[model samples]
Target: MSLDSATVRRIAALARIRVEDDELPRVQAEINGILGWIEQLQAVNTEGVEPMSGGSPVGQAQARLRPDAVTDGDRAEQVLANAPDRMGAWFGVPKVVE
Candidate 1:
């Protein structure tokens, strides 16, 4: 599907983007280019292709996990003690905004 001027404006509004009146044409062209590329990708045949995680193909190699070890041992109190305001072992900060 091709991106039109109105659709581009609606997309920008939904994304909370503020595009100048003069820049709307450029934004529309960019969105159209992206949509055209996506449409081209949809035309490809992937009947037998398996979805892959990461750069490697599916079932190509197995991943390894590190052995369980003692990394940090009971440092909660030591960490909490450094906070500016501690409330029974928790950091306290003022409300960020309304």
Candidate 2:
């Protein structure tokens, strides 16, 4: 979808980006170019392409996983010793929400 100047300004505001009045036109053109490239990508034929979940493809060499074991257990006392506020076996922080 092509974006207008007003739409580009709205996008910048939504993203909390401060775009100067003079830079609006340049930003608008750049965003429009990106959208055009996306449109071109959407026009490609990929009816039989399978969706990939990660960077590596399926049936490829997988990363070796280490055995799950607790290497730093029984250190709760030491960990909580320097805590400003301790709640039983956990560190306590001020409640931010009601």
Please report, as a residue range, the 10-residue window in candidate 2 with the lowest summed lDDT: 50-59
lDDT against the true structure, each candidate: 0.88, 0.92
Q: Residue pairs in steric clash, candidate 2?
A: none
lDDT of 1 by residue, 1-98 (tens): 88778888999999999999999999998988998999999999999999987978888877887888978668889899779988786788898899
Give me the runs in candidate 2 sitting further than 4 Å from their true place: 58-64, 72-98
Worst 10 residues of 1 by lDDT: 65-74
lDDT by residue (8-32, candidate 2, tens digit) is 9999999999999999999999999
Best by lDDT: 2
